[model samples]
Target: MLRLIAFAALGALVGGVIVIAVGPSTVGYTVAGIALPVFIIATVLTLIARSVGNAVGASPEAVQQAKDARRLGVARIDALRQTGTQINDQPLCELDLTVQPLQGSAFASTMRTIVPLTAIPMFQPGTERDVAILLDGGPEVAFIDEGELSPAERARLRVPGRGSVPFIPVEPHQRIVDGRRRGPLLGVGRAGRPGRIALFTVVAVAAAAIVVVPYHRAVGQSFAAMQDGRLRPDLRRPEALADAQRALEEAIGHDRVASITVAADFIIVEAPRSAGDTKTDRWTYRDGAVTHDGAATTQPESTAEQFSWTDVALDRVWTLMQDGAEQVDRPVGDALAYVVRATDDDVHSPAFGRPAGPPEIMFSVGDDYGTTSFVADADGSGLTAR
Candidate 1:
């Protein structure tokens, strides 16, 4: 059981390391969410099975004694009754048997034993059968001899030998020693309590380290990234958006920006090289840095409707839609996107119809549950939810 728990903890540690290496992204959270529950369930089932086995199964000492019992004896079943117990689908029965040794008179005794399915018919009352008993131990336990008796076996049993007893006498205080009672959590044996405690302490600390170390490392790295602006920017804030716009303008070195897209973490900007150019240069601003993403082919007609960044008030649009936007349970802040571009009448929805006007801003907000979009006219007017 300890080994099983250790393996499970190792698997969890590996998963945690993978999550940390992947960083605090959607994939990391998804893997952690699935793996943590699975690990917990596996560990719980393992402990439950161990507890059940220890409760119902024989102890190590009793099993060893049974294996060591080899003296031959004869027994006739006087009566048989079920104890209303079972082990591995086999019925445990109490048997009254008259034991007949090679040299002594027969004696009647009662013993509780698990009757194998295949041997049930052979163990009926008045049936005489070969038995093996422990000569040195108490006669509380005995095993049915299922092997065919040949002349050699009779010779060995009939002749007196070393460590041979006429019959194992039943002791009044003797009862079946199933096992020593174990603690609910550890299942340690009677002796060695201090050793078990030390071992358990070590295992507990190791298991805790397996779960905590990687988590703390991941959190620390995430905090460092946030401090360095290498993580998601809070686009729901007005100042963050303004700073992104300024960064975009500085990267492009011109005010002739075509469009801007503000996402949860980063911003995308498009700007034409010249006043009437059909191709526009694209830039991606993220982690407090901007990079040119080369040129993209733009429709000449779309380029004619370009608007200045100052024409749209993103703060007003965010404020108007923030309260009405759908919320999600994830840690993804706001879970929203803002796209400012020329109005396209083709962008239609059943809830808000088509957008037909000057340049417009489309706000997409929500998370995994669902998304709600709001279309607003340039200058943050005529906000329509879709």
Candidate 2:
């Protein structure tokens, strides 16, 4: 039960540390997607650690040779030399060193080995010091008697061993001392089961997942989506189009619109006037945005000429009716009426019965039994009675 709690706590601590290390963008995904799975993994590892520790304890005589090797006299550091700035592509200082076994005269000559700078203790070189060197084969060298080091510091100075020349110098408590920092320790029997180390390794991998998955989603996928338009279309972009429409309405005024034309990134609205004319207002839109002109404008000084004449001019007539401009006995009827001459071209003229004047274009408010007929040109000119 305690093992399970330790595993859970370790998983939680790892998850929390990862959430903070990766910054705000990862906080949500880390908790939502990573924490539960990590807890499960840690629990399994803790159980395995305990089981393996017990198995090793049952077979103590199996590694009696390793126990004896550790009791060998310490090796002495003779000199230290900096090799280079990197090792196996890792950014760290490497060193060349010379040492000699103190009690065991195994080597006829002084021993030379290459070590990563992290393995050395915090002491000046050229002084005789107790350290450990692997007998089999290893590039690392470590101090043997560095006391009371923190976990991180101990990791750096830990010696390398294969078939067990003692993975690390034995703690006093592991022997015959009743110390406060007691077991459920990892990796060693009676102190900590080897499971603690494995549990931590699992936690590290889980924490990495929390940071990496969210970063790939938020940063990587977004950049990929930007390269292709088929990934999303204008219909999917409601916010952008809505904002552009608002800008258009504010530009032309809401009460003036007769018809609106929409495009992928632009909008055009036609507004009609009581004078039987139409004005065109246009606006452009960018994705994820809606920027309207600050000062709303019903009509600007200059506009497209082709949009206000001929068949398009009918929009203004429609706007006038929709706005109730024809209700109060206004000049809307006369403003739209026109007459045609038989001698002039009549193709463009309205079919207002028999032709009687030059061809003309005009707003058509209403046509009745011809009581008060009026005529004008396309420019609202040439008004006269037949």
Candidate 3:
């Protein structure tokens, strides 16, 4: 709940500030267009974190689903659970659902809505039949266990033309991933016309819109100044980072940003606020940081962007990513891995060099199988993983 509140608050603050600072502009083109969308995204993230956090404790419906799939019925095994010091990519009972292109966007008209399922009987890392599902109105294909499909198995589906069809969709088309496919997917009944799937999708979009639309409009307003170039990102300069920190502390009201440190490209604000093993993380950029002695903490007078540079760089990347977006792909239960290259003098490349000296290129990359936080440092580089 706190996480959700944080997200909503962040959106509200950012959006509200943008809206007020820039006044009102186009209703369509503003960040408000994606406010609800962004909040919708934040909500999804929070729910996912909560769900995975609560994976060990099975809900009644989930238990029943297991029972229904069992011999006597999906029997309730005492929610078998185990966690590790690390994260893994292998699904407990990895299931990949390959929806045809159209089935995926629902609104898009290219492919039939295929709801492939290699779904786990349980969400946690446990044991169940590794399956691949095909939802062509009904279960079009089901890969039993976690094995390759035999010729006979493939032939059973009466796949017309092309003769051979992949047992499962690979790469981009494989949509349903990890536990996000939890709860239930939009379903379809017999006739498939009054498609329950479509209905569910409509309801979902509407529900999401109710929240997303408002959030979208509100946010666009928040960043209106920046978008207009009037409120340029202050973080573009190293000194401006301090000013942003001062402003943030003032906003938190009395909350201290005393521990906040400024980096060339980023600001590390050591906000100590938690009683548990973990605490919340807040990321935002402004004009300045507040201090107790009625003055700005670090540099006296600096630029204004603060850490806002990240937003621009990310946006630029997103814009340029349009063309090749079709080529990139991931597994059903896998996630999109985005990396940030190193930039300081001590920073190294993400790849290895033949004969290294003071410089080493290493990637602090992560994927479904946890993280591969390794550096491509050579013998004489004098650099090590931190």
Kindly list the per-residue Cα lDDT of model 3 for residues 1-386, writing each as its tens digit: 33334355445445444443433334323545555566666676655443343222233443334324421101111132323212244322222222221122111011122122333344322222222332222122232332233444433332122212233322211233231233333222256546654554454445434433443423433354356564433332323433454455544443422133333223444331322212323434322222223323332111111222222222222222221232233221211112222323323633233121222223232345544333322221322333
Which model scores highest in TM-score?
1
* TM-score (all chains, Cα) for each model: 0.35, 0.23, 0.18
lDDT of each structure? 0.56, 0.37, 0.32
- Provide the global lDDT of candidate 2 against the true structure: 0.37
Regions of candidate 1 where Cα sits further than 4 Å from its true position: 1-232, 326-334, 341-356, 367-369
Best by lDDT: 1
Q: Model 1: per-residue lDDT, tens digit, 177-229?
A: 53232333454445657766667556655654555453453344345547857
Residue 154 of model 2, lDDT score: 36
| lDDT (tens digit, per residue) of candidate 2 on 188-220 | 443454566567557555655654454332233
User: How high a TM-score does candidate 1 get?
Assistant: 0.35
lDDT pick, better of 1 and 3: 1
Model 2 has a clash total of 8
- At residue 238, candidate 3 shows an lDDT of 26
Candidate 3 — worst ten consecutive residues by lDDT sum? Answer: 105-114
